[model samples]
Target: MKSLVLCTFLLISLAGCAQNNKKEMNQNYSTEEQEVINVTDHLTELMIAKDLKGLNNLLDKDFTLTHITGYLQPKAEWLKEIETESMKYYSFKPVNRKIEINENKAEVIQQNILDARIWGTRNHWHLQQIFQLEKRNDDWVILSSVASIF
Candidate 1:
């Protein structure tokens, strides 16, 4: 009977320790996710503000942007389009967003409803955008953006 009691106590103690450890690990993971989200927010803000310099700084040189219309844009082309006002977005509101982190890489999925005027044509575009970010030297930068039209 004593041995059984001791075994039960030990099991209960170990279970409590495991639960505490899991909670701590979850908190740490949440913090890491927040960091990735912060970088993603900055990228979105820069895009909405049309901050060319900020976008340039946050986007990798070899970054690629793929549109829902089956068009692919390289870094230079996207930058030029933004700089020359060829692609203009009056407002971009994300309806839903999710972030996933794996080691040094993060994936951001954003569902946005944008009121944009592209080449003098007013349009409401609902887009599901996936952005990949790579942490380079502790700084997260956008590596790719792929979108789907809905």
Candidate 2:
């Protein structure tokens, strides 16, 4: 009877440990996802603020932006538009967001309603943006993006 009780106790203890480890793993994934989300939020904030220096730090050297009109803009041209106030963003209302991470690379899809003025014309647009990011030197940087208007 004593041996039986001892074996049962050991089994319960092991099960508890397994449960705890699983919970820890789930928490770790959640933390990683949140970190990615925070980086994306900061990117939008920088765009709205027109912080060119901050944007420069977040964007990779080969960053490219594909517009809804199917035109591709390199980092320099995109930065020039922001600097010249040609693409002015008043606000962004995120409708849906999804993120996927694989090792050091991540992709984020965001659907948003944007209140903006482009080249002196006021517009409210429903936009879908796909952002690709890479982790470099312990920092997350935007690698490229494609944007479409719906």
- For model 2, the local distance difference test gives 0.85
Model 2, range 1-150, lDDT digits (tens) per residue? 999999999999999987776456335446667677778778778889999999999999999999988999999999999999999878876666788999999998877788878778878889888999988887889999899975
lDDT of 1 by residue, 1-150 (tens): 999999999999999987776455335447767677667667767766889899999999999999877689998888787777777767765566778888999998877787766556668888888999999898888899998975
Q: State the weakest 10-residue window (summed lDDT) of model 1.
A: 21-30
Any idea how many clashes model 2 has? 0
Best by lDDT: 2
- Listed in order, each prediction's TM-score against the native is 0.74, 0.77
Error of 2 at 136 (Å): 1.4
Residue 22, model 1: Cα distance from true site in angstroms:
28
Error of 2 at 58 (Å): 0.5
- Model 2 compared with the native: what TM-score? 0.77
